[model samples]
Target: MRRWILLAALWLSAVTPACAAPPAPPQRILFVGNSLTYYGNLPATFAALAQANGHAVEAEMILEGGATLSERLADGSVQTALAGRRPQVLVLQERGGDLLCLGGRQRCEQSQHALQGLAEAARAVQARVLVLGTYQANAQASAALVEKEAAAARQAGAEYVEISQTLADLSRHQPDLPWYAEDGMHPGPALTLLDAIKLHHALYGMPEARTLEIDAPRYGANSGLQAVLRRADAAAPNAGTPPHIHYEHAQVERLVRALDHAARATDPAPATPSSAH
Candidate 1:
């Protein structure tokens, strides 16, 4: 009897908040980004998180790589082409490859323009704005970019959610954090998990956890079936799929397979982000 009581206490401690749920909801979200964002499985991370937490989710990511927010906003390109559907949130981040443009004369100005466009879109669709500040790189490392984006969001009366820096802080120690991918352009699998963890902290009030994607389309069109764990994004709304797919016998056919491997191999998936609110 006493032994059983002690075991229950230990189990409860293990499942407590910090070791429990993160604080975000794995709900409907839309990500607007470039190649890096695509690789992170931006939408699928949330979807995966929802599954972990025993919830259903819907998320999407629009391909806009190498194009800064300013560039994407121009010509009503990204926002205009969204098919007029507004999600609960729109995540905007600078192009990872654009790190080379950091400190350039036009960086700040371009970011501002992009912020304006994002604000306009958010307003038009009644959605919130999640500014994915620049990732950690030699030239583009600074809280200013995030601050400026947040300022613009506030000015425009848009709610903001920050992630880059927090992840940076976490990455400083874990060098193998997968902050960079093989291309040296986008974040590898780790960053996506980190983003999901942070995002959970934002939307939910649960404990915290990072992820390792088990499934994905391909590392790139050619990276092959590697053991990477990034996030996955959903196709655009009302977006149709290809005519057919072949999944007969692949060593590792898709990202989902990788996730399956992870679940079978390592510890269980982190609990879903907190969904208290």
Candidate 2:
């Protein structure tokens, strides 16, 4: 009877189905901010950069012109966006200065509150949060604010992408790099591309990786913009030298034109140069 029972147990074990492992979630990232994020759908560009570096990623963006984190938190847009899509990374950015934070005590407290709220939301969704350093038109004025924000972000347990320093360097090298639109306030594709590359490096720990090209189709509905981006991507620093990251003036102009046209299509107002940030 013992031998028979052992045989029956072995048979049952052999026939039973094994427990299945849950499917792995897609590597998703969500970018939340104002015009700085929206213009080029930079999150998508960043994802493309990552893909080029052999990482599969999905990126989304929440953009509103001249919006602040506090405003977004109050509007419920941030929460709604995060509910269904539990992203692996949540990127937060705002305009150059504390336009919405007001000033004095209010500015400091409100900024902290918003960051806290954002961090909490990210935590609930099991996502890491990243804060973009402030990029001002005057690079000189950026240092102090950037340092303050970087420390605050660290305190909030969020990584800070120091793109402002990168931008300042590039702008100094190529004074007319078309980093900003005619208004000078918003970023053009060239700048956005740099941001994408920088963000990719920061996220993947591959600062030296240098493939700056991405599928132009992902730039969205503007064919002119797509063509411009494709052209720019094709123009690496050196020909037959293995695609080094560099920018050309012509490529920058083409991208700026594409952005200008797109911006004009929505608002026929004449373009003006705003601050670089």
* Per-candidate total of colliding backbone pairs: 25, 3
Query: How high is the lDDT of residue 120 in model 1?
Result: 78
Which ranges of candidate 1 are over 4 A from the true structure?
Answer: 1-27, 81-83, 96-103, 138-140, 206-277
lDDT of each: 0.53, 0.62
Per-residue lDDT of 167-264 in model 2, one digit per residue for the tens? 77667766766688656677776788767755664566432233345443223222122101112223222233222233344453444344345446
Candidate 2 whole-model C-alpha lDDT, 0 to 1:
0.62
The number of the candidate with the highest TM-score is: 2
Regions more than 4 Å wrong, model 2: 1-25, 99-104, 207-277
Q: TM-score, each model?
A: 0.60, 0.65
lDDT of 1 by residue, 205-249 (tens): 232233334343433423221212222432222223221111222
Overlapping backbone residue pairs in candidate 1 total 25
